[model samples]
Target: MDKVIFSFLGTTLDAGYSAGRWERWRPTIALCQQEDMIVNRLVLFHGGGHDSLLKLVIEDIHRISPETVVEPVRLQIRDPWNFVDVYSALHDFVRRYPFNTEDFEYLVHITTGTHVAQICLFLLIEARYFPAKIVQTSPPRNSKRVDKSEVAIIDLDLSQYNQLASRFDEERKEDVSFLKFGIATQNSRFNATIAEIEQVALRSSTPILLTGPTGTGKSFLARRIYELKRAKHQFHGEFIDVNCATLRGDGAMSALFGHVKGSFTGALQARGGYLKAAEDGLLFLDEIGELGLDEQAMLLKAIEEKRFFPVGSDKEVSSQFQLIAGTHRDLSQDVKDGRFREDLFARINTWLYSLPGLKDRREDIEPNLDFELERIADQLGKKVRFNSDAKKSYLQYAMAGTTEWAGNFRDLSGSLLRMATLANSGRIDEDNVSVEIQRLKARHQTINSDLGVDESGNSHQDWLELRDRIDPFDQVQLAYVIKVCKQSANLSDAGRNLFQQSRKDKKMSNDADRLRKYLSKFELSFSQVKEW
Candidate 1:
């Protein structure tokens, strides 16, 4: 490959009056005479009015190294010591220069420019404007003639070294861990998504939307992103988190947009809204889909303009804060249904991310359990550990396909809190876990039954006749069970899923037989009902 060097003319080092110049080495010309490195081309940059000097250096370079080609670029720099001027000049030169890395190995000579120029060169090189290592030349040893000046090449690529590479890799892992609340989650997709969230949190100041089902860590992740940005000194104002679901009516407007004194009957004093309170910081609007149409419209205006009028006030207040919104609602659908504003959705949808629920991320349950236990230890002021049998039993049930984690992480945390509080001598034995499992089953069953009031409008003559056969009280539950059956792969699968919790207590191991017996009472069979 052809060797090319970019260097600035050393006004003092390259100055020579006679043949004695061969005794002293100039960096711009010294790099060309090296035994191992060939200067196939030299692009020299210098301030104006150095035509004579440029002439002498080109002729000298050719005399000693006849094969080297010299190209002179006259730089327009009023002060080489000024960072802005020197950087602009060099930047323009690099921008216009034709760089063909495949055909040539290029080197930037940092030994010739002023300190400011050297720093600018390093910055541009580090940013990868043009790919090249830096060449630094110095005078030779005392006994050796200056003509034999030493040359050192420094490559800025850090990944070539194992230590530096590993350090950066480990730091990135830590950032991802921080976003996950330090849980050692094993889900590949979840881990990769968290890594991307960390990057976006640190790099972008625009709004971020985190969507997931309730208790799926949407709010938690939003706060973690805020903290990460705060730690990086991205913003200094206080973090203001408001759950829009709890807000309602004009009060919602006043709470978010503040109210001037005497704005309303209850407006005893003027208040600075959350937006103004979050100046230069992060404002997390959790459950943002709960905001009314008017509130959403005003919020969109505030987000885009950074200015909003207070209640009953004409003057507008300005705030510069980053926004991170969290919601369990499908906002796109909400937009279509006229429940949410499309323009507002469009503004915040750019960096949207969906967090998987605990049911969807069953592989992470164990680590999250571990994390909860650590928190329990802190909260209750006593360390707790589950015995071998208890942990095995709980994990089996928790990770089972039949288990429905409708409440997501909130359910797990509450369950852990109860068990830890009820532990015997800081140990949760098998019996303790057994009782907790039964309690959890009843809890989930009650919730499921409450939701079984069949509004699904399943109206068929056979179904109506079958429904009339059962008690009015049993119709809701029977209908829900049938729905589950229809959605399942087969009778056994449906029964196994439906009776998973109750199966823990029954002595008989046959879920299918139990389901069949119940169905017989209703004069229905899985094969016949599944078709309906």
Candidate 2:
């Protein structure tokens, strides 16, 4: 690093005022000297301070750099403050004592207050007396006099600063690849769907509405649209996702259209609201039906007119965002009930695409399973493979209609993650599969019982009584048994099917035992139940 000449131009009040707190300046002065920068002179622009404290700072600087000259200039200013005069005085001092290039490689103008700093910087920039670098130095907020001069420096590289500003402006451009669906699919199936989604995205500029059951990758589809649009240069914006359920009443309006300073009790600064921030990008409103009527009205107007007023402002700000909304609810029913706005519903309904539930897409199960397993493996930082027996067990369980995947893709992903975590010897086996299956079945049964549904799909009078009698372990065992019995329609044939499904020689005995236990629980022997 080249030797730099640093100048301190700010008041004691700017450094923060308290009794005996002036000692903090010593460490800061010492830091400047220790750097490749040489301190040729120390100028103290004093506002109001005891002469003893000023002497202490000067003496400390002298001890660190003996050849350094100290010049103390007393400033006469107003009591409360006049910012214009303060800026003029600082500007005058810099012009009068012009820095010689040979004596200083760089000039560092340090300030404590943002207002004072901004004024001083503006003056310097206007006069072309700007330093090679402007550094903001301030004491840590919480500390005693013992640890005073802990400073944080922010280097304002004009080029990099401009780049960051540009990035903020271009923040709406999003990479959709980061958003992935949890379902596993075969290579052929995955590629085909992605290609179709890309085609739809390319052809349409209408608001895309993704409708599906919860956890069926509605959000993922929205992100894919954003990605496809970005890739095709259809829109140079980013994807801003907002779960409408989280934004309630005043929060919803304030979040969508920001408030001005002092608009509300806690409104500190005028912020660019989400709509403004998402300029020209895709705004993903998840659970759109959950938005309050007032907010829905405002959102509808913005979507139709491309403008909205901030919470406190009268001026309508322009918003040129692509609207992508997702919902699990039947909005048409909501409209009929007068809960959701019919007008807003019509706007989003323009280009709606409903996603099929995972259960409806059994063909995708195998591929999605593999994809989720790979994802889980990557997350756990481990390498795992599904053993043939484990894979078969998983397929049978998945293909069975007993387990209703209420959470859809998300539930499948979680199940795979748990299996990945518990896999032994880097391979998931039938025992682990059985254990996971039983656990999931137990959880689902509890949930179903709470919803007052019995095992045979009948409404129970006492759901609690039904729940007590139903064993999740037995349910899982019976589901496997039912799958085998349905496949062969004979006890001996079902046992053979169970053995084939097990994929392990040791598992054959366990399979036979499980089969018998499953039959006993149903209160029927193989001969009585079997059609063959």
Candidate 3:
């Protein structure tokens, strides 16, 4: 590969312009002589206002080494100290420069120009605006030593440095911790998943699909990923997050793909939608399973083509944005049921991570208590603390097998907010913990009770009481089945509804018989269903 040097023009005003006299050695020229290897070309950035100095520098480069090709780039800027102006000018200049990384090896001379200009160059390099290494030049102590000598080339690849690499790893851990809101979790699998996510966020723009139960922090993590990417200057636009579950029919389509003026009943003006709003940024679709088929088709097209036509608009609008989708529902199952598009699922499934539910990451619960408390304090302007007894009591109950956190982090957050609000003198006592625990239990019991209601308004609590009676997998499935049963007029109706889509592919003679036998395994029947 041919060597190419990218450097800024340093003023030679310090050196007298007297005939047959030179005070200082130019850093750009010195950059060329640092190593024995010949630099094939030089891409030099110069202030457009300084034409004479530029000419003199070009002459000096030719005098020192005529074989080296010089490409002078004129950048207009009033002040080097004005970082915005200098950086913008340099950024535009480099962007317009046709760079072929495969054929030429590039080196940025960080030694020349004002300190501000050097910093901007370094930032551009770090942000990968150019594929190059930095080179710094120093003048010899004895001015009489006119031969350009002192120079050091800097390689910004930190992975090569053991100590610096370790420091970076530590900082990455901190970043992951911040993403989790300081939840000091010890679960190895969960920690490893987070580490993987961190890598994906930094390295790839591929659509990420976060799958997990509701309130499992999928949306939170998606937003955090956007923040991380934005902080790194990977994205310049705002993060657009939309919960797909709340969208319905025309509203869903319009909100996602936008609508033209007079497109629908209420679209009075041309709407830009979430996609256009997230141009050059990130779009996090929480509960992505709920989007309608037509919307999904359009979304698939947009993801692939980076352009889509707004409703009732002939013109196609373009948007380039990273996508992060979150969902509690099994999209594969949805695809099989013909509710979700298989093509869309396949497109987003490339970078999929299943975020663990609160039950799975129980170790994180304790630290989350403090996080919640701090969050509440900031919002309410009142500080609160869980006393020793209260803290132990709450943790014990929360960590126990009976305490099913159905709502996951949302449940934990709500529990802490209530306890903190009810605390006496800014301290939550054992009584407060006990009351909150009982309240949570009642709320959960009420939900389970609703699934197993009898004719006489008795809470059979079949699902509630069977906490440790059956396998957790069976327990969850059966609970859902029973819940559906409560809404049906009869066992046959419940069975048909439950297997409405799945039974289509099966040669089943009696859906009711199949459901009945399944219920018998759990000692449940239709007669038990009424009002929980």
Candidate 1 residue pairs in clash (backbone atoms < 3 Å): none
Provide the clash count, candidate 2. Answer: 9
lDDT of 1 by residue, 149-222 (tens): 89999888887989989998998888888899888899888898899989898988889998999999887887
How would you order the candidates by TM-score, starting with the best? 1, 3, 2
lDDT of each: 0.87, 0.68, 0.83
Better of 2 and 3 by TM-score: 3
Q: C-alpha displacement of 88 in model 1, angstroms?
A: 5.0
Candidate 2 lDDT by residue in tens digits, 57-167: 676667667777767766554431467666666666666876656656444545532366456655575455755555444555566543343444444554468878777
Worst lDDT run of 10 residues, candidate 3, spans: 13-22
Q: What is residue 406's positional error in candidate 3, in angstroms?
A: 0.6
TM-score of 1: 0.78
Candidate 1, superposed: residue stretches over 4 Å from native: 9-36, 47-69, 75-91, 114-116, 139-145, 230-237, 251-272, 301-320, 453-532
lDDT of 2 at 383: 80
Off by over 4 Å in 3: 1-141, 153-157, 453-532
Sorted on lDDT, best first, the list reads 1, 3, 2
TM-score of 3: 0.65
Residue 472 alpha-carbon offset, candidate 1, angstroms: 2.3
Best-performing candidate as measured by TM-score: 1
TM-score of each: 0.78, 0.52, 0.65
